[model samples]
Target chain A: MSTSKFVRQGFPLWLLAGLLTACTTTTVDEFRQGETGIESHEAIVILGRRQGSTYETREEFVNCVGERVSRGSGAIRVIPEKEFVDSLFPWFEPRTAPLRTSDLQALMEEQVVADKIEEYGVRYIVWVDGQTETTNRTGSISCAVGPGGGGCFGFGSWEDDSNFDARVWDVSSFANVGTISTDATGQSYVPAVVVPIPLIARVEANACSSLATQLQQFVNGD
Target chain B: MFAVTGNRKTTATRSLRVLAVLGMLALLSACGASSLVVEGSYPTPAVRKIPLSLGLYLDENLRNFLYIEYTETGAEEYRVSSGQTHVQMFSNLLPAMFERVQVLESMDDAAAAGVDAVFAPSIEEFQLALPQKTRLDSYEVWVKYNMRLLGPDGAYIADWVLTSYGKTPMEGLLSVEGGINEATVSALRDLASNFTLSFGAVPEVRDWLASRQNVVSNQ
Candidate 1:
């Protein structure tokens, strides 16, 4: 069977996989330990962004990775985007590309920012950006309700794929350390009886976990 | 009645334990608040001795033993007076490394002491960076010094500035003050060692000391 046809046929099984895997499996495509040589056990910020929409998506992914980086990896601290941006760029807020290496260098030159960095001993900044979308959809669902009796039922399936890249930068040296990329793909199903029951594949969550793990590994020289 | 007596014993035991814990915490805090005096001396290096009067221009801040209290607002005003400054520490360290070194309080003292040359050392900067839970696993301390070698006639011989850093891993359960002081001691030790090595190794200093020795011999 063609790959697309097979994926369409395996919608139920994919939903089952989603139910079984509390955290979807993560696949890492690229993990380059950059040359900055920053210590792993230092505070690093995780930021997320996308070309369209606001910073909501970035915040969600940053929270996810920040939690895992602190808990799973032996990282001394993982700074979330909210804290990083709120403290550093309180007035102007854009996670993806507003701040560059030169901008950071200039900030570091400021006495206040320099003092803060020295106090916290921050080492690295990890910038994450990506998109997760429904790649394919198949089957159909329908529902109907009458005044005497109300009933609705439908069955449908869709495939979701998440792609994200994380770039690590050293705070002191103001240099890029490395990059980590992750791709997570899963199929979901929706069964509508009286109400719609959707089994959603945790594509974003899987990508976050994988990217965080790889970033930690890259920093710790693992 | 027996049950009541047993309960009373248990209550007494628990109370005693709580008291002991509180006492220990109190003791820890008291000790943590105290300033640290650097103890011990580095072994004199194997080198020719230079007889000179050393003038110490100690910064007022370095005169007090300093420690840090890791707080939300960062470390502030935790200093203790120990009757000695970092200059005095250097004074204590120099006698061992040099053949004959006299601590001169002023240029007048150097002139009266009939010393060929004088060395003036001043603290440029001092910082004790305490470790934080989410930020750092190691404590680091930094010290910078601006030094000048001058003749008793108030003529400058040479000038040099040196910055040294020391770091140590944060270990055990103790007060932030204690941890920072330990790291500071390490940094001071390294700074002293570097100073001694540089003092003897610098070409200009070596020549100057050698010339002073030759002048003394001729006289």
Candidate 2:
């Protein structure tokens, strides 16, 4: 191959390589930053996450909260998803958009008064929400030259990130109880990459425990 | 030609190598790429108790269902379908399942009748698993009852047929002697205990409320 030919071909390859490297590092840093902003809380109301027919994610959160509460100082009661659905009718249902502060306040007042009269001892209620994202990319090439300059080449990369955000509302008076968010992101240069299992697990467990602690404080009026 | 060909091959090979690495990385990243994120908040726990009042005759029946096995049939089936001979057996049994609360308050017929609300026990279904004749005719019964508490404001509380079951002796003279009678009673008692633990008023709450009232009186 002539020097000019090599330079022409190599320059783009070098640029692509630099871009790939930058993208990889940038994604990793983004993940780390995403992981950092997670806020902590003492108490939280967990809502249901559904896919077709399964609410596995929501169930997991419930279990996580239950375990954390069981280990902590205050009492914890899990409101069944059915009850949450019922609450939505009067508070979240009629609304055309995401809940407004006034709507939440109204819910708080109604629930608190009704609960106090019916349950007498109930002191608070909590709620939560979550979201996730994924992406993939690939490239390939093959070529052959007998007596001429000919060769085929191909390249590709894929990346994915998952995030979770949670918010809490006080049931007694519809106040913002607390909020938290956690994220786990990873990328692969190969056909496949091992997800950061340890990282996801750590963040989920930590966030749950942190929320439990916040709930304890709320109950304590701290 | 050789040098040019060699350089071309090297460049191609390097590019392919990078692609292969990227593909593998993609697969690896996607491999368990799925995540489970959970957020939960606690709700104020609700505590309520519905009293059972059917006079002494029904109360005794409830006690019997809690302690003894009658024949090889389960209490839920036997009691529910005993027909007119039993009349409203569940009405008799609902109060019995709540023996703990009644025991604590000594709520007699007069007190129950005067209460602001009452829950009528409704039967949903009764299932019986009986032992094969060779196995001594032992059988298990599962009974589901739906109950609704009516106040001046209409239905105030409801519980679906929470199931309870008992096993009884299937054969010999034991079946004739009512081997299941004891089992049915025990099963009923166990069911009652579980229900109370889950939804009944906390005993401590009652005590606290009483003490507060006493303090006010003292003041």
Candidate 3:
């Protein structure tokens, strides 16, 4: 191909590549120490801290982490957030309030709670807490609903940042073992011209994977 | 002047091509989706004192979107919202059905938890659908699950797969979002019921339980 022809073809390809790269930007951070004494056969229950009407946990983020932890950590089983609630909600309901590790011991003292724990063979309970928010936004987009379907026009951009922390508590000892956290930020852009093109960063998903991997490593003590 | 005109034409052509490519991509990506939480409890068999360890392995896609197929355009896209994720559905509902079930967060935790055996579930095929172009219609969700059973020693006991379906009618009075949530609730309930029905009947699981019982008796 002529140099001019090559330039014409290569330019768009480069631009496309750049756009794709910009879309997938994510940072995963974690820390851990020696074997935390958790065994492979034990169970870790991930719970969401309730905040009034809503829970502190994000459904997508929790599930993502649970899936990754199960897959990444060999055969290590993860007690999903849903199961955690099903198993523990009854005890929690009495309080009509949120629970901290401090409250578990007293509850554990109860025969029913203790029996349930032993029955379930729960080793550690992980509490996930955090939220994702739009940190910043600049630009505007407008839409018009016409008889012929509908359309949006203009350009809009927003930045979403997610901050989450995973706290591990050993059920047997009723002690807090360690904590892992993730802070992921994603930017979204919408360019509307008859249609809107959205570029979503998936920051929460990144946070999920990061937290899950780190929690696995922390529990495995590897 | 001729050379200048030729370069301008090339530039314009390149710009148009770029715009065309972007436009196509945008059009293809027009589908919108949302996620919902699946909530509810299902009836399980009688309580067994011997605790069973349960593990869930969800497909990453299930955590992301609900796949909806448009009949008009013959286009398939992951564009349904869910209140609860696939992981949440299994994790939350499974324990309710069983009396002495331990839902492990990680496989490593299972060994220490003193579980006799483990159940690992993975998604095979999952889809949620409603008639295309109609805001008011019944919504349906279906899933195929691939399951694996392992002993405490990590021995592979059994591998099986099961499919389940759920449906809910959309009331015209409710908003579109509300209808979607109702559908999700129904789908989750059916999936949980299906799990209890099939999982209890698995021979490998029975064998494993018997073996575990023997070990307990000896101890």
Best by TM-score: 3
Model 2 lDDT per residue over A4-103, tens place: 9978776677564545431211111111111111112322334533322211244466556655654555555444444553333222221111354465
Between candidates 1 and 3, the one scoring higher on TM-score is: 3
Q: Please report, in order, the local distance difference test score of every candidate based on alpha carbons.
A: 0.66, 0.41, 0.64
Reference contacts preserved by each model? 0.00, 0.00, 0.00
lDDT, model 2: 0.41
Q: lDDT tens digits, residues B4-41, model 1?
A: 99999999999999999999999877755445554433
* lDDT per residue as tens, model 1, A1-222: 897897887768857665754334568976464554455456877776533432224456778888888885366487666555535432113322345677778656656556655666678877788877676798778777788877568788878788888888788678777778888988777888888777777788778888877877776667
User: What is the lDDT for B107 in model 2?
Assistant: 28
TM-score of chain A for the candidates in order shown? 0.75, 0.42, 0.77
- List ranges where model 2 is wrong by over 4 Å: A1-44, A48-75, A83-98, A108-113, A116-122, A136-160, A187-222, B1-219
Candidate 1 residue A162 C-alpha distance from true site, Å: 1.5
Using DockQ as the yardstick, the better of models 1 and 2 is 2
Q: What is the Cα-based lDDT of residue A111 in candidate 2? A: 48
Q: Using TM-score as the measure, name the better of candidate 2 and candidate 3.
A: 3
Top candidate on lDDT is: 1
Residue A203, model 3: Cα distance from true site in angstroms? 0.8
Candidate 1 TM-score to native = 0.42
